[model samples]
Structure formats: C-alpha cells, structure tokens
Target: MPGFLLNLNSVVICSHGGQAKPTVPNPRVRVMGMPVTTLGPPYVVAGCANPPPPVNVGPCVIGNWVLAALRVKVMGLPVLLQDSQAICVPTGTPLTVVLTQMRVKGM
Candidate 1:
C-alpha cells in the first residue's frame, strides 16, 4: 500500500503509548526536510504505560520495524512509510504510526 513516507519528524508509538524513535535515520534520503527512516534499524521506545508482572510483562523498551515500503529505497534499503508495520520487543506489540510527512508517498 502506498502511504506517506516516515521521516525523523514522524510520530510513532508503541501499542502501550511509548514514543518510538528510529535508531538510524537514512541521511541519504530526505522527506519533508527530515531524514527518512528505513527498515532494519530498531526503534527505541520510552515512557510506555504497560506495566510489568501481574498486569502483563510490558512497558515496551524497543521496537523493530519489520515491514516498509516495497518500492522506495534509500541506500538500497526499503524506506519506512506511514503504513509500515513494527513490533515492540519483549512485549510483541505493534507500533502505531501517528503521523508522517504528507509530502511524499511510497509503496
């Protein structure tokens, strides 16, 4: 599916509401004036509300993007998009794409 490209400015979060930040944004590609995020690099999560133990083992601390644009590439790696899918480590929860650059779209 085609969707807006994800940039360093894109707002992404884990299922538990933790903010997700790309560990590495591709400097070779820019979208909406920010570096575009690519697959492979893990996203670090912080401030997750999901509690540990009895509540459920969570409070997601890291995320890995497993899916991304099929056609868009930055340095031979697929670029992440608004529709890209990611999973939080340890919790097995998915990341939510809250916002992305509206200027560029990719499959």
Candidate 2:
C-alpha cells in the first residue's frame, strides 16, 4: 500500500508537470458548456464534470508559476488553490475554462 501511495503521488506530480507545460496550443477547457478562464497553467479540476456551460474555471498553480520556476529559493512549493470565488453557472451545463495564467496560492 505504501508503494501504491508513492506511485500515486508520482502520478499526480507527473500529471501536474505535463499540464504546467502543455504543448497543445489553444487548449479549450469548458465546463457545463460555457467557456472559463483559469488562473494557472491549465489544470483540470478533478471531479468537476458536467459543470454549467460558459463558466469561469480557475486553474490551480503554485503561486503563479510551476514548481520548476521556484528554483531553490523557496524551501517548498504550496498546493494550488482549488477553490475560487464562485460564479453563477446555470445548472445542467458544462463550463469551459480557457487557461490564461498560472493559478497561484493567492490571487
């Protein structure tokens, strides 16, 4: 189980790393059918399926930059902000979040 946890952690890290530097240009992220702009480097929030369309989705970032940018100055990086000011997304729709910036700890 410990090994599984470690692997899972690694999987999460790798996933974040890939998202931090997406090679695909103009990656479209939608929720509940509406388009949204995320705060960070385009991270898909887990388990936010079937969101209302045309919603503003914020991405999770490490203080506006990925851990790669932290260098050695910061002892460790903080987790990305998972929640933001809630916007009214109409029910029964998927929202689209277009990532514009990196989601940092604080807005």
Candidate 3:
C-alpha cells in the first residue's frame, strides 16, 4: 500500500453587516502519510492551503481490480505513469486520493 504526506489547514469565517467577514485561523489537519482509505465523504482532505480539494463520491473499480484515483488541486497538474504499472504525481502539490472498493460480479 502507498500513502501520501499532506499539509492541511482549518479556517473559520464570521459574517457581519452586509459585507463578507474575515477568515479566522485554526489548527491545520496535517494528515501526513495517512492511508488513502481515510480520505472520503463527510470529511474532506486536500493538498494545498489555498484551493480546496476536489469531491470524490464514487468507486474506482475496473474489471475485477480496484484502482485508486487522486484529485490534485493545483495548477498544471501533471501525471506520469511508470512502466505502465504505477501512476505518480509531483511534489509541492496538494492532492486528495480515493481508494476503490471491490464488489465482484457473480461472486
């Protein structure tokens, strides 16, 4: 199993009058080297401190194998598939990974 190191941050905003409120600083949820299975719905996990991570609400199953797909929220996202076996993303980028759940047909 492979894992990723993520740098995260939490923020809070308060509204007043007719203008938008400022953001309040909170503790960052640094999910360093956490399993991809832990990243899911109801609880969002992303890469950067700027743009939020993409939403993943589905399974990533193919044939009889389950494949994982990571949504990276960054500029010019580049993906490299090594030896047609593994896929990789660069560093200094924020990513939200999703693991596939298996449900074989006629099992």
Candidate 4:
C-alpha cells in the first residue's frame, strides 16, 4: 500500500500510548525538511501506562518495525511508511502511526 513516508518529525506511539522514537533516522534522505525513518533500527518507547504485573505482562519499551515501503529505499534499506507495521517489545503489541509528513508518499 502506498502511504505517507515517516520522517523524524512523525508522531508514533505504542499500543499503550507510549511515545515511540526512532533510534536512528536515515540521514541520507530527507522528507519535509526532516530525516526519513528506515526499517533498520528499533524504536524506543517511553511513558507506557501498561501495568507490569500479573494483570498484564509489561509496558511497551521498544518497537521493531517489521514492515515498510516495498520499493522505497534509503541507503539500500527500506524506508518506513505511515502504514508500516511494528511490534512492541516485551508487550508483544503494535506501534501506531499517529502522524507522518504528507509531502512524500511511498509503497
């Protein structure tokens, strides 16, 4: 699916509402004056309210993007898109794409 490309300024969050920040943004490419995000590095999550006890497993701490643009590449790696899928570590949940730059679109 073609969608807006994810950039450094993109707003992403874990399923539990934790903010997710890309560990490394691709400096080789820029979108909307911001560095584009690739599928290589993990996204660190913070401020997750998921309880860490018997009630639930734990809060989402990290997000690993498992899917990205099929044809878009930055430094030979796939560029992340607004519809990209990511899995949150420990919690085994997903990351949500809240906002992404609409200037660039990719598959």
Residues 1-107 of candidate 1: C-alpha lDDT, one tens digit per residue: 99999999999999878999999999987877899999999999999999897879968988998899998898999999888998898899999999887888889
The RMSD (Cα, Å) of candidate 3 is 17.9
Best by TM-score: 4
User: lDDT of all the models against the reference?
Assistant: 0.90, 0.25, 0.20, 0.93
Query: For candidate 1, what is the lDDT?
Result: 0.90
- Candidate 1: which stretches are off by over 4 Å? none
Ranking by lDDT, best first? 4, 1, 2, 3
Question: What TM-score, computed on C-alpha atoms, does each candidate reach?
Answer: 0.95, 0.17, 0.14, 0.97
Locate the minimum summed-lDDT window of 10 residues in model 4: 26-35
lDDT of 4: 0.93
Model 3 Cα lDDT, one tens digit per residue, 1-107: 23232222212111111111112211222133212121211222222223223542222111110122244322222111110011112112222222222221110
lDDT of 1 at 15: 88
- RMSD per candidate (Å) reads 0.9, 14.7, 17.9, 0.8
Model 1, TM vs. native = 0.95
lDDT of 4 by residue, 2-106 (tens): 999999999999988899999999887898889999998999999999999899988998999999999989899999998999999899999999988888889
Off by over 4 Å in 2: 1-41, 54-69, 73-107
Residue pairs whose backbone atoms clash in candidate 1: none
